[model samples]
Each structure stands twice: as structure tokens, then as C-alpha cells.
Target: MKRGAETRTERRDDAPRDHLLDRLFRSEAPRLARFIRKSVGNQDEVQDLVQETFVSFVAAARTGKLRTPEAYLRTIARNLLWGRARRPQHRDALHLPVDEDFEIAVAPEQEWMMEASDFLRRYEQALAELPARTREVFRLHRQEDLTYQQIAERLGLNVRAVKYHMRKALLYLDSRVNTDD
Candidate 1:
């Protein structure tokens, strides 16, 4: 076989993997974006984080089989977030003014308060969107600090049902509260 034929054979061999990666990207990108948005205030940064997560996920996927791809993607995103947090900020020394008395004032507390209020508002909206039973389950578990078994007993549901509702509630809330929306 000629070199051209060999290249074509290699491309044909990779077609299935490429298709799988494309499907994975389509399905998981929005979910990952929402997850990252919870921690990242800036939409651009959230997008960048999600892109980085998928880039790492694709690299890993190409290397070996992933038993739980969703979980692996989340782990990659978390590591990227931590890495960004640990990176030190750099300022240009050449741009600094020669005057010794120059000072810069920043109101970090006010900025923090604004971000907190916005998050709370979004969280409340997400909670309100949940089904009544799911919302109650979440409130009982989170606000009242009840165990799953206790919540099950209180709501006359099986423990599994309570757990299911909690999971549904969390996923819905996470998707709804994303700043990208």
C-alpha cells in the first residue's frame, strides 16, 4: 500500500473516536459551563475554564478508556480552577509611577457584597423553579440539616426517593443559576 493509502486507513480508524468526542463535547459543554459558572463570576472566565476542562478531558480520553467521563471532566475542571486560584498576580513594574506617594484604593468588601447578593438572588430563583416536593426535600436536608432517612420519614417517602429528589433538585439548581443564562 502507498503512504496515501496508509494515511487514509489511519483516518478511518480514528473516525469512531472523533465522533464519540464530538458527541461528548456537545452533551457535556453546557453542563460544565453551568458548573464552572457557580464558582467563576466572569462569564468569559467560566467559558475558558470549561474549554480547558474539555481540552484536558479529550487529551486523557485519547490516552485511555475513561470509566466515568462525566466525573473525570468535573475533576479536570476543579483542578483547573484550583490552578488558576494559586497563580500569583503580576503587575508591570515599567508602568509604575515614580512618585512615592501614589496609592491605589480598592473596595473589595463592596465588590464581595454585590457578588454575594447576586448569587443569593440567582440561588433563590433556582430554588423557586424546583418542583414543590423536590424543593421541600432540599429545604429539609439543607436548611433543617436533616438526614436522608429522617427526611424520608417526615415526607412519607422511601430513603431512595428522598435521595433521588435531592439529586434532581441539585442538578436543576446548578443548571438554572448559571450566569451564562
Candidate 2:
């Protein structure tokens, strides 16, 4: 076969995948952007994170079929956010201005502490919203550091029931705390 013909054939084979990717990007990018924006205050960083999420999604899609692409995109975006959170801040350099007299900068640690406190407040509020039994199960497992079996025994419930309460508590918390408005 001619080289030119092979190139055309390869393009034809790739067309469907390309179309699928384009469609996915169109549908998912806004949702992903909103998700990232909730966590990141910077618009530039939000755009960068959204682009990175799509890049990772495309690379994974090329390797194998994604069973749930939307969820996978969310997982990828969440991991990126976590990774960004773990990195040290360079804001001191970035925010330095020409006029030293008018400088206005907050320390990174202070900002982190504020965020942590806010997260804790939201978490407590969400936990408060849970049913009494579910809240008890969560507190026993998380705050008191009890195993499911231990919690079950302590509460006079079966292991399966304890697991169910924990699951319910977790889903409720996730929806309340992690959801993007």
C-alpha cells in the first residue's frame, strides 16, 4: 500500500475516537470547570486544572475503555486538586509588588489554617444533618477510632447494619461538603 493511502486509512480509523473525544470535552468541560472553580479561587488555575483533567482523560481513554467516563473525569479532577493542595505555595514570590510600602500579603500557613477551619465547620454541620444512629456510627468509627465490628458490638447491632449506617453517613457528608454549588 502507498504511504499516502496508509495515512488516510489511519485518519479514517481515528475519526470515531476523535469525534467521541470532542463530544466528551464539550459536554464535560463546563461541569469540570465548575467543580474545580469551587475549590480554586484563581481563574487561571481553574482553567489549567480543567485542561489537565481533559489531557489525563484522553490519555486514559486511548489506553482502554472507560466504563464511566464522567465519574472517571471527576476522579481525575479530584486527584489533580489533591495533588495541587499538597504542593507548597509560591504565592510569596508571585504576589510581590513593586511598591513594598503598599504590600498586602497573607501567609500561606494562615490561609491554610482558615481553610482547614472552614472545612471542619462544614464537616460538623454535615454530620449534624445525618440521622442520629448514622451520626453515632460515624462518630464511633471516625472520632473514637472504632472498627465496624467494634462499633456494632458497642451499639448492639449487627456488622452489616453498622456498615450500612457508615455508608449512609459518608454519602450524606460527601453530598453536603464536596458538592459544587
Candidate 3:
């Protein structure tokens, strides 16, 4: 039967589905939190949005319209991220001084270079924590600017595996670095 057309009797008759929700709450919460952390740029905001996303998911399920729960949760988080980005406080904080009068005239050259070096070092450390194959593919594509086919050829991995590794590595680093930033 179509989901919404199910009789009220059938809705109450599902015990296994209730157990499934219990398990989902335990298993999916942390994973969703991490995903939200990666997609949004702040830790506190991640926590808030995680709660909001799950609450929305539960509400949708109760209303009998959540066909793909995980995807729906992620879509909620993506929307939250965009909303946060559009807020006035965030906008003001992120504003760049683009006027000519804002140009730097007398900064020491090595200052910016040292900051860049430190940032790259931290970034490399995070990259190094990934699986060896994932790291290798990432560096080849990002640092060496190699195409996925080139990366696959050099590493002897199938192109699909390379793509999977890239996605995993990016998600891992996203949760780790973006949260702290």
C-alpha cells in the first residue's frame, strides 16, 4: 500500500519499526552529528543543527512522509548550513575589506608566508591520518593536480575506488578541520 494510505490499525501494528527507530537514534545520531559538523563550519552550530535535523526527521516520520530518512536528514542539514551562512552576524564576520584603502602596504613578507606554511603543515597532518591509499590519491589529485584516471593509473586502483577514497578523505578532513576553524 502507499505509505500514507495505510490504515490506522496497521500503523499501530508495527513493533519492529519502533525498534528500528530506537536503533537508528543510537547509531545515526553520531554519524549525522559528524556529517553536520563537516558541512557547517562551526562546532556549536553543528550541535544545534544536529538536534534540529533529527527533530525534523522524527517529525516527518511521524507524519508518514519520510521516504528516505538519511537523505532527508542530510538535505535538512545542507539547508541549515545555507541559512546560517546568510545570517547577518555571519555575514559581517566574513566580510572582506575589498576597497583599495584596505590594501596592506607594509607587512613583512615572511609573516604571511610563515602563516601559510603552518596552515599547510596542519592540513598535511590531517591528510596523513587517512588510509594510505586515500591519502595518496588525494595528494595526487590536489597537490599534483592529476586527473582521477591518472591517479588510478599511478596507484593501480580502480577509478571507482579512487573516487570513494577521495570522498571519504574529504569528509573526514571536513569534520576534523572545518569544525576547529
> Relative to the true structure, how large is the alpha-carbon lDDT of every model?
0.79, 0.81, 0.70
TM-score of every model versus the real structure: 0.51, 0.56, 0.41
Compute the lDDT of residue 126 as modeled in candidate 2: 94
> What is the TM-score of candidate 2?
0.56
Q: Can you tell me which runs of candidate 3 are displaced by over 4 Å?
A: 1-18, 94-181
Off by over 4 Å in 2: 90-181
Q: Residue 136 in model 1: shift from native, Å?
A: 37
Instruction: Give a tens-digit lDDT track for model 3, residues 1-181.
Output: 6766677658777776788777877877788888866645568877888888777777767866455566666766665655654455643343365786786443332344344444555666788799888888887876555679889998888899889989998998877655435
Write candidate 2's Cα lDDT for 1-181 as tens digits.
6999999999999999999989988999999999988877779988999999999988878887776788788878987876665454622224455675786667655576456445656777898899999999998876545689989999999999999999999999998888553
Assess candidate 1 and give its TM-score to the true structure.
0.51
lDDT of 1 by residue, 81-137 (tens): 655543433111124455768875535533544455566568888999899999999
Higher-ranked by TM-score: 1 or 3: 1
Ranking by lDDT: 2, 1, 3
Q: TM-score for model 3?
A: 0.41
RMSD vs true structure, all candidates: 11.2, 9.8, 11.7
Could you tell me how far off, in angstroms, the CA of residue 108 lies in candidate 2 after the best superposition? 9.5
